[model samples]
Target chain A: MVKLRARCLLLGDAAVGKSALCHMFHSDGTLFQKNYSMTTGVGLLMKCVNVPETNDSVELYIIDSAGKETLVEACEKMWGQPSLLCLVFDLTSEQSFASCSHWMERVHAHCEGLHVPGVLVGNKSDLSARREVQGSVAQEWAESQGLEYHETSAKEMENCDAPLLGLARAFHSLYQERRETIQNLSPG
Target chain B: MIDSSLTSLGAKVVVATSSDENHPPENIIDGNTTTFWMSTGMFPQEFIICFAEPTMISAVTVDSFNVKHLKIEKNTSQNASNFAFVGEKELEHTDGHIQTNAVSLNGSSATHLRFIITSGYDHFVSVHRVSVQN
Candidate 1:
């Protein structure tokens, strides 16, 4: 059985459903709209996900960080630990989408030298009518960055598992390539 | 809802109350913040400050008292200063009795306006009272 550890950082403006997504993805499958106080500091949770393809059981450390000046510092603290980063943005607001640029820059600065897989998530996809961003615009941005994009409705569990599953596959592919490169270098 | 008061220093002070304390939001560090956004009104174009600090000096305060204040401009982010202090002289007069400090903004003009509390404590610097001086 393969065991992997990954940390997913949720970066976005205040009230962008970062915490809500964390709750939804966890094993509980519960929904909370109780208006959790804005995360002043980092809020963390851990869940073990079982991948059937590789028979791998991976533990995901999810960080729902507060959107404040401390964000830069926190990102630096968890810089090397994250294997996958999700830059979450709200669908209803254009400014929230714009703010994702800052988050991307901060993540890039901290993850220096390492190419971590990233996904751009347009949250609140359930609210299509109120959505200020077009999927194609987000897709174009993601394409330029060479990152995958997904519009998810954590509220309804739509496209929620796609990124996590995709990340697992990407990790497996990288591992296979590394194994092949190591074999090629072996004397045998 | 606009105030008619006009002061020489700052425009009419704008203050609003929290909708409900029953639901205060938490931040990253577990620090709590209550949101209070006052509607625009007839106020001088200056920094409208808001603060939240303990009401006492006690044994904790040494160099400065914890005074959370902010300078807000129209259609812009508020510049916040946390864990600040009023001048020693101001604290000396108020004697930590800040509950009666009147929480007032200057009525006339100025470059840098400071709030000085001598003594006593109020435990909160809410956006309650607002006025302007001529």
Candidate 2:
């Protein structure tokens, strides 16, 4: 069994369900209103995901960084990880969607030229009538920035896992291509 | 100005708030010789408190709002207050309004009992009276 290591960062505005989304994916249940700091520092967790197609497993280091300004030091730590970065925005809050550009800019500034795969996720899609950002709008914005986008409702578990799975597939394909190129260039 | 009718001691109190960078007056804590008064508007979980006494017990007198609980902490030496769990008994619940159980400091009076708002509604703990009987 192939054991791969990956990391994922969840970044967004405060109270955009980043923590809730993480809990849903990790624990597969709804947690009650518990102690929530404004994400003071980075909240870290680790999970192992079994790839159904390859029958391999990958251990993911999940980093949920603080959205509050007081925790800039914590958010700075995520800059060096070459894992997949996910930008979560609240569909019902237009301000959150508009703030996506700022978040993306921060990632770009920190990651620099690293090939960090990203996903633009518009959460709270279940509340369509109250949506501040339409699906097409987010998709267009993500496409323009060379990032993949998906609308998911963590509350409803809608399209919640697709973005991560898609990124894993892309990462695996890229790894394979790199290995093939190196093999062909070997003198032996 | 000190109110001698209740109790008298000197210490510090910490009040936490969740206001954004552009927002001011997040919370207020004015310390007196014997007690500290506070007004907070953030959610209950967002507030925190720390005390200045060593091996000392601290009690929070919550008024004007209903709290699920108030987290308490003690110190052997001066350091950050660790999370301590405390339960509440209904002091008064009438006409859709509620109050908290009065916390007591076991007859042993001290200079400091930090009032941190760990979680609950938005209100002020006016502290109408306090006495260090011990």
Candidate 3:
């Protein structure tokens, strides 16, 4: 059994339910705060996910950062190097969806041209009547960016764990691939 | 009348709640914003700095990251204990660069200064440097 650790960065626009989604995932749907003060900096949360039909597990160190433009610089300094990304946006707000591009650019810049495994999360799915970003559009954009797309309603605790679980599996597979390459390098 | 980094004037870190080998407690008074002391994690983390002698301090400049609330205390005694609350500030959050904030100390005299990071924007907080103005 292999135990791995990965730093997962959570980025999104303000009031897009980034914090809500993190809290839901961390608490296993047991806790969800209705009133959230804007996250001033980065909020750190951790959870371990087990890979199905395997003894391996990945511990995700989730760095939930403030989405406010004013605090982005400060948050970036603490981001260090992330192994995975969870780019969230509110389904109800088109502006929030539009800001995903900027967030992606920022993350890419931070990675220094290295590919980081990630997913695009369209949160607040419960507010379907107010939705401004269609699911098909988000899915297409995610595919274009080489990312998987998932819809979640953190308030309703629906599909809150899938994205993170997917991240853990992705990280585990990357680890396995690296191990295989190193093994191949060794002489018999 | 001269402002100086406390470490240059013989300040020593007496105690730190948590420490990391890569980011030690001594980095706080090292006078360099690039080098820093990072908290391992958790709230109400603190550190104590003892000066060579009791000196009058007008203000303190802190270069840090992820710090949300800071509470400062001081003592004139020689030992590490006996602290009196001096001041507190709710730090403003910043992105990318360090949060350089000058907190006025009301010209208080002290031999020891205690900085308690009561809370932070993240689980980990970094103190780049701490300087004092006389």
DockQ values, each candidate = 0.01, 0.01, 0.02
Task: Name the docking class for model 2.
Answer: incorrect
Regions more than 4 Å wrong, model 1: A69-75, A78-80, A186-188, B1-134
Task: Write one digit per residue (lDDT tens) for candidate 3, span B47-112.
Answer: 999999998999888888778999999999998788999889999977666788888889999999
Instruction: Point out the worst 10-residue segment of candidate 1 chain A by lDDT.
Output: A179-188
Model 3 complex DockQ against the native: 0.02
TM-scores for all candidates: the values are 0.53, 0.53, 0.58
Kindly report which residue pairs in candidate 3 clash with one another: A72-B95, A73-B95, A73-B96, A74-B94, A74-B95, A74-B96
Taking the tens digit of each residue's C-alpha lDDT, what string does model 2 give over A125-187?
A: 899889888888989998887678988877787777766665565555544443233223311
DockQ of model 2 vs. true complex: 0.01
**Interface CA root-mean-square deviation for model 3:** 15.5
**Clashing residue pairs for model 2:** B44-B118, B44-B119, B44-B120, B45-B119, B107-B134
lDDT of 3 by residue, A1-188 (tens): 65666788999999999899888987898788899789999999988889777887777889999999999999999887677899999999999999999999999876745567889999999998999999999999999998889999999899998898788887777666543332233111
Instruction: Identify the candidate with maximal TM-score.
Output: 3
CA lDDT of B68 in candidate 1? 31
lDDT of 2 at A82: 43
Compared to the true structure, candidate 2 yields what TM-score? 0.53
What is each model's TM-score for chain A? 0.85, 0.85, 0.96
